[model samples]
Target: MWIEGAKQAGVEAHPWDNLAEEPLPTSVEIEGTTVPVKWLPKPELGESGGDLRNVVFVYESAEPHLRLRWQWQARGDFGPVEHRITIENLGGQEVWLLMVDSLRLDWKVTPTQNLRNVYVEKGADSPSAEGTHLETVSDGYNWKGKSSTYAHPVKDEKREIIPAEIVCDSNGNGWYAGVEFSGRTRISLERNGTSLKSVLGLDPEPGPFKTRLGPGETFETPTVFLGAFRGGPDGAGNQLRPWVRAVLGNPVTWKDPQYPLMVNNSWGSGMQVDEPLALKMIGESKELGLEMFHVDAGWFRGVGDWYSEPKKFPHGLAFIADAAHREGLRFGIWTDWTQAALDTESGALNVRDPKVSDWLVTDLKPDWKPEDFKGQTIDIGVPEAHDWAAKEVKRIVEDYHLDMLEHDGYLVAQGCVQTDHPHGPPNRSTMRVIHDWASDFVLASNSTDVSYHAVRAYYDIYEKTRREHPGLLFEICNDGSRMVDFGSAAHGDYFSITDTYDPLSNRRAFYDTSHLLPAAMLESYVEKWPVPKPENFLYMLRSGMMGWITIMTDTTAWTPEQHEAARKAFELYKAQLRPFIRDAQMFHISARPDGVHWDGLEYWDATRGKGVVYAFRGSIPDEAGHHFILAGLQANKHYRLHFEDGSQPDHEVSGSELLGQGLSVRLWNPLSSELVFLDEVAARK
Candidate 1:
C-alpha cells in the first residue's frame, strides 16, 4: 500500500511476483529446523479500541499442532502503523520456536536517490562522543544498530542505539521504524542498487535464538512501528514525539498539568546522605519551588533489601516522606530493586539463601561482594523471581510513601547460567560473558531468549504497579540512559538520559534523544558541575531544564546570590518553559554542542503562537555570538523577541528574517547563556 503521499520514503509498489518467494513475512524454526509458512488469504477483522483497528491473517506450516497468526494494527488518525507475528502451540506437546521478526519491508526507491540514514544512540551510561549519527545509504550500503537495556561497546565497534532509524533523501522525506521492546533488539538496513531492505524485531543473534512454546502457549515478536515523513529528521521527530505521547504515554499522567515535575535529588553528597541532609534538602526544595524530593541510592537499607537505612534514617523512610510532604514536596527514592547483595537482613535477597540462589542469572563467586550501589542481577524472567519483584515494588511504593520510584542498575537478565530457569541457560561452550561497566553482558545462543522473557516479566510488573498506584511516576535508569527507547517510554514516566551531568553532556544527551521522544519524557539530572559564575550556574541548570529537571546537588550549599538565581530560574521554567517542553515543536537549531561552539534549541508552539530559544555560548574565546535559524514559523508574519538576560536589545523582526537570518544571541561571557522568548505579533486575536 502507498503511504498516502508522494513516492519518496515508503514501501513502493512492486510486482507481486517480486515478493513471491517471501509473500508471507512470518517464519520460525521448530525442533532445530527452519520451517517456512504458507499463508492463506483468509482475513479476520476486529476493533481493538476507539482508535485501534486490527487485521489478522492466519498462516500455517506443514508442521502439525501449530497455529501462526500475523496481525497488523492501524493506530490513531495519524503517524505510524504497527505489526507483529505470533505463534501458538495447540497440542499437548511442547514446541521449540526461534527467529521471529516483528516487521520487515522492502522499498523500491529511485536509483541513486541520495538517501541518508538518520539515527540516535542511547546515552547508555553516558553520552558517547557521537550521540546522533547521519550517514549516506549509497548503493551496496549495509548497516545495523542494536539496542538493549544498556550497552558497553568494544574499544572500536558499532554502539547500541535508541532502537530506531530514519532513512530519507536530502529533503528528509523517507520512512522511519523502531522496535517497541526494551529487551535485546536490533534494526537492519541494506541498500543494493535500487532496492532498500530492512528488518525490525528481537535480535536473532547471540544465533539461532530459541524459545519454548508449551501446550496452549504462544510466543509473539516485539511490535514495530513504521511511517513516512517529510522535513528531514526534525520533521520525522515532530510527528513521532506526539504520536508516542498520544498512543504509548500514560493518559493519567498527561491529564495533570504538572505531569513533568521539577525535582531535587540527594546524590550530590554521594552515599553520605542521612536524615539531617534529606530534611535540609527538602526545605531547600520547597524554598526553591522544586516539586519532588528524591532520595537517591544511599537511602536504601541495602541493594535488594529495599528497606530504609536504619542508622541513616533512624525514623525510617516514611518519616522522611512525611517531612517532605509537610514542606509541600513530593517524595521518591531510588532502588536497584532486582539486584542481590550480601545484606543479611531477614527479608533481604541474600545470595546465600537457598531459594534466592536459584533466582540469579549466574552463581556468584563465593567471596563476591557487591559494590557500594551495585550487586548481582537476578533473572526477573523466572516466574518465582518475577512474583517476588512485583511484590517488592508494590511494598516499596506503599511503605515508603513514594510519589515516584526510580529503578536503577541492572533490573533484568539478558543472560543466565542457570539451566532450570524459564529462559533456560546459554550454551556453555559458545557462551561468552563480559564483566564490564559493573554489569554482565552475555552473548550466546540463549541470550536473546533470556532477555525476551525477562523483558516481558518486567513489563508485567510495571503494568501491575501502575494500575495499583495510578499516579506514581516510574523513572527507568537502567544504569542511567541505557534504556532510552520506545519500550521504556511506554513503561516509565521518564528516563535519566545520561550519567554525566555537566552542561555539555546534558545538552548533548537531550539533543540526541529528544529527536524521537517527547521532551517531557527525556530527563536530565542537574548534577554538581563547575560553576565559576552565577550565570554559568544557571546555564548548567537550564541545560537539563529543557526537558524534565532533577537537581542532584546540595542546594542548601548554594551562595545566596546563586540561590536567588536558581529560584528565579525555577519560577521561569514553571511559568514560561514547562508548557512548551510538554507540548511544542522542538528543533535542534544548532549543530551538536561541542563545548567550544555556540549551541541552541528552539521550542516553538505554533498553536500558542509563542516559544523560546535556549541559547548557550560555549567555551570558545572571542566567539560569543551565534545566529540560530528558527523553524516552524510563518515566513510572512512578524515576531517580537524578548531577551531575558538582555544579551541583545529586544526588537521586532519579520518571520522571514528570523527564519532566514536567524535569531542573534550574543553573550559577553564565555560560559553564559540566554533565553530568547518569541511570540508572533498576531498572538492576541
Candidate 2:
C-alpha cells in the first residue's frame, strides 16, 4: 500500500484517489532522458531501510474482475543486481498465477541456474540429459537447480522462457534482449549501443514464491539481473526499475520476433482436391484476403511416398500449385516427411531405406488390426535420409513452384525408436531423435519463402526456425494449450489459429486464450462446417483479434453471409490490433469453471491512450445476476459503451462518475458480448 523507494526517487505516494486509471504509467525519467511509460497503477508501500528499496505498482480494474498490485523491490547488490517481485493478493479470494517469466539476458554468466521444476526424459541420450534432477521442496514448488555447464548452447533449454533472438543492428551496434526466469514472469531489455533503455516486465505470480496460497495467502518471486555499463550496475534491482516501467508504460517495441497468419486445411478432409473443389476454394480464399492456402494430407502417394497420388487428383500436385499461384495466393503443400503411411502399395519397410527401420515398429502386436497398427515414424537424422528428404523436397519446390512447406506428422518416428539407424546408436531418447530430426528439417526445407510446421516436442524448434530463416513463420500446433507454454508463445513465430483436432471450438477457445496469448496467433474457418450463427461469428471475430485470426473451413463453401461475416471479422480485428496484439497487457478479470457465466478480460494500450474490456457468458444455466465492473476508466470524461455482438446498445457515461463508481454490466441469458469505449471514455467527467 505504501512505496518506500519512491521517496528516495523524490516522488509522492500518488494516492488511490489521485491514481491514474491505468495499471502501469507512461514516461519515466531516469538521469535526464524521459521515455514514455505505458500504464501506471498505484504503488504498494512496505518497510524500507537497511539497503533495501521497495516499490509496488497496483492495477485496479473491475471490468474483468478485481484490483491487483505488482510489487518489485531491490535489496542485494553483491556486485550484480538482485531484485524480488511480489504479487500481493489485493483481491479476497485465492487465484492461480498460471504463468510467470523471470529471465534477464543482460546478465552474462559462465553458467546459470535456470528455474525448472520438473524434468522427464525417455532415455540417457535425451536432451533432458542433465545429470541432476529437480528436487521437490513443497507440493507445487521445487528448489532451483545449482548452476551447471552444458555441453552446447541451449536456447530456453528448460522451456522456461519464450523464444528470444540475439539480434545485432545492421552494424551490430544495438542489442535487444528478452528471456524468462524465476520470480519475475518475463524480462525484456532494449539497449542501443550506450544508453540502457527502459527494461519491461510482467508479474502473474498469484502469491508468494514457493508458498502456495490458501484463499488469502500471497505468492511472490524475484526477477534478478547482473551486468555492467553506462546506465549503471546491471544488478537485479537496477535492471528491474526500467523493466517495471516498461511493463507499466506498455512500450510497443519488443525485441522478440512477431509471426504471421496462415490458413491450414489439415483438420478437415484430405487435400487431393476434386479439381472443381480446389479451384473454388482458391477463388474464395483470394476474395476473403487469404494469404497462404496449404493443401494438407493425401498429396503424396507413399507414406514415405514422395510422389503425388495421381489417382486422387487427375492432373497431379502441379495443378493445385499453379491454381493457387494464379489466384494471387501463395501455394503451400503438406509433407509427412517423418512418416511412411505403410499403406501405399510400395510403402513396405526395408533395412536399406534410411527411414525403414525408423518406420518399422516391433512394438506393434500381432493382434493389432490394420487401423490399429501403431503408426510408423521415420528417421530424419540419418545423412542418407536427409539427402532423400532434400531431394524429394527439392522436387516439389522445383516442380510446383511452392511458396511454403507445411511439415506435419514429422513428429511420430520409428526408425530411431530402439534399433540402430543410419544416424547413430540404439534406444535413443525420443527428444534427441526429434531435435536432430528438426535440424535436418531446416536444411531440407529452408530454401523457401516460409518453412512452417505443426510440432509436438522441443520448444526451441520455433527459435531455430526463426533464427535460420528470419522472414520465416512457424504455425505452432500443440493441441490447443498443451504445448502452448509461456516460452512457446514468447518465442514462436506464430500461434496455430486453432487446435488441429477441433476447428469449431476456437470461437469459445479464444476467450481463454486471451489471458496471455496475442490475437495474431488465432485461426478461424470462414466457410460453414456446421454454419456458425451470427452471434458465434461475432464471438470468434472479437477474440481472434488477439492473434492471427484465420479461416480454416473448406474455403470453397463460404456462403454469401459467411463471406460478409469474414470481411467484417477481419476489419474489426485489425481495428483492435493495437491493444489486442501489440505491447498490451492481457488481464484475466474473472474465472468461469462451467464457462457458462460471464468471464472477463481487459486490454490496456498505453500507446493509444485506450483500453478495452471484454465479457462473455460461457454457458448459461439459470438466470443469475452477472455483472462486470470496470476500474480503469479515467475521471471526468464522457464515454460510450456497447456490446461487440450487439447484445447491449450504445450507452454514454463519464469516467469521473465511474472512477470510484465502477461500471456494473448486467446481462440476462447473454451469449457473447464486448464493450468498447473510445479514448474519450477515459476522459469522462
Candidate 3:
C-alpha cells in the first residue's frame, strides 16, 4: 500500500522501493560509523498565513544520537513546497559529520517504446550571463554538477556557464527545483531506464569537510525549493518565479505607491561627475517628472573611499542630498564598498598583498604569486575589517542623509584566500562568508541568531542602519548584475540589469530577466547611444517600460524641442505603463531578439481588466512590422484597443477575436516601436 502511494506521488521504481514506508534516507557519521536516521511516524502539522500548511518531521538515529528537524511548508494548493533542515546533536558525545542532504525525491515514469524527453532550463548568477538554456536528457545518463565558483574576477569569461535553477519537463509534466542559497550548492538529476531521482544539498568541503558537532551543537542547511507543474517548461519556469519572490521576503512590491522613476547620471557624464553638472541634471530631472535623482560613481574619493570628493563637492554631499529632498526627489549616490583603490588615502591593502597574508583565506593557491592579484580587494572576513566597513557605511548614510546607496564592484574579493580569520580556515568555504556579507548588507533583518558569526555581524550592521534611517534603499550593482540572486533580491530593492547601452542587448536582457524577476525589481536604463533620435530614442524608452525606467542622458546637449519631446515620453510612460508594470503579469512574447526583426512582450492585469503590449522592430530596413497573439485576457469580454502613437484609430473588439486573430503592429520606420493599450469595456448585447 505504501509503495502504491509513493507511485501516485511521482516516486520512481528502485531496488530500495520497499523502503518507501520509511522517510527519505538521512544519515550522520559519528565516531567513524555511519548511522541511518528514521523519521517519527507522524508529522506535526499546523496552519500558517491562514491558508498555508506547515509540517514538521523530526528524523533521528538513536545509535549516533542526533536529531534533524525538517520543516516543510506549503503556501497553498497551487504554490510550491519550501523546506529547511536543522540538525542538532542529542547525545553527550562528539559527532564528526561529513554530509547533509536537505532534500531527496524520486519522480515516477511511464514505460514507453521510445526514450522519453526530459527538458531542462538553467540560469547563471550574473545579469550579463542571465538567460535560460534548454537541455535534453534520455535514459542511462546522469547530470551532476555544482553551482558557479568565481576563483578570479574574470573566471566567468573562461568557465562554462552553469544554471542557477535546474527545471525538467517530461511526459507532458514539469518539475522545478532550485537552491535558495547564495553560496555554493549541489544539484543532481539521474535517469536509469524507468526511474528518475533528484537531489539538492549544500556543498560540504574544505572547512565543513568534517563538522565536529559537540553535544547541543546545531547546524542548519540553506532552504531548498521544489515544485511540480502540469504545464510545459514555460509553465514550470513561471511557477518558480513567484515562489522565489516569496522566499526572498523583499518588502518592495509593484503596488508600492512611492516607487520611483529614477534618472541616472552615468551614461551622459561618465564617472567624472561634478557638483555643477549634478545640480543641472537634478533641475532637468525634476522637469522631466523623474522621481529619483542619482549620481553614479565619481562623487567619492575612490573605489573604497566612501567620503565625497572635496573638489567635486566643496560643500559636502549633504548639500546635494538636501537640495534634491527640497525639490521633492529622493537622492542616491554610487560607491563600491567591497574594494579599496590602490592609490586611495586609506592605502588599504588588497587581499593578495603580502602584508595582509595573515588576514586572508587559505584558498590562494601556493603556485599563484602575489603579483597575480590584479585588483584591490579587502578581506572583510576579519572582525576588525568588517567592523570598520560597518562604521564607514553608517557614517556615509548619516553624514549625507542619503536615501539610496548603489553598490558596485562587488566581485573585487572573489579570489580572497586569507584563512587566519575567526570564521574558519582559508579555503573555498571562505568565499561563502564574503557572499553572505554582501547578501546581509543589502537585506536588513531583525533576527539576532544567525547560524554564522560572520553573517550575523554584517546583518547587525544593516539592522542598526535601517533602524536609524527607516526609508533607506540599497541597489545592488556588481559590474553589471554579477551578484543577482535570491539572496541579493532579498536584501536589495532593485537590480540594474546591465550597464551596457546597446539597444539589442538591452532588449534581450529585458526579455530574459523578466522571466526570473518581477518587472518592478528589474530596472532598465536607456543608454545615450545611437545618437538618441526621436524614433529610436522613443523605442528605447518603450523597451525599458517593462521594468523600472531609468533615463541616462545629458540634458545640456538636448535642444528645447528635444527636451519637450522627452518630457512627453516620460509622461506617457508614467501614465500608461507604470500601473501595468506594477500590477500585471508579464508574458514574454519574444524571449530572444531575432536579428533585424520584431521582438516584444505583453503585460496584462486580468483582475483589473486592462493591459499593455510593447512591440519593437530591428534595424533591418526591409523588416517593417510583426504580429503577436496577445495573451492573458478574458476571451468573452469586449475591449477597447488603441495605439500610444495615435497612428491607428481606437476601435472596439471582443477579447476572443483579438486572441484568436492576433494584433498586428506596424512601425512608422525601421528601428521603431509601438505601445497598445487594452481595456475591457461594456459587453456587447
Indicate the worst ten consecutive residues by lDDT in candidate 2.
444-453
Which stretch of 10 consecutive residues in model 1 shows the poorest summed lDDT? 13-22
Q: For candidate 3, lDDT tens digit of each residue in 1-685?
A: 3223223334333222211122444666666787766654333332233323565666666766777676766643343566777777888987755556666766555445232233222212223443444555567657654532221223334321222444444443655565554344457776666666767665543334444566887766656655555445445545555555555644443234655355645446776788888788889888877888888877876555567788999988899988888889888877666454343365444444455444433334433322111234454545676776677778778888888877765432322333344332333423343333222121111001111333334445666766677678777666555545554565667777665656665676566666566667777777666645678767766666677777777876777876777788778777778777666777766646653788888887777888888888887887676777776677888889888887588888787877887777877687788888888896656
Q: Is candidate 2 or candidate 3 better by lDDT?
A: 3
Error of 3 at 145 (Å): 6.7
RMSD of each: 3.0, 18.7, 6.7
Q: What is the TM-score of each candidate against the true structure?
A: 0.95, 0.53, 0.80
lDDT of each residue in 179-247, candidate 2, tens digit only = 232112333333323222223233322212122122443433323432221211111212322333233
Candidate lDDT values, in order? 0.83, 0.40, 0.59
Question: Higher-TM-score candidate among 1 and 2?
Answer: 1
Q: Evaluate candidate 3 by giving its C-alpha RMSD to the native, one decimal.
A: 6.7
Candidate achieving the largest lDDT: 1
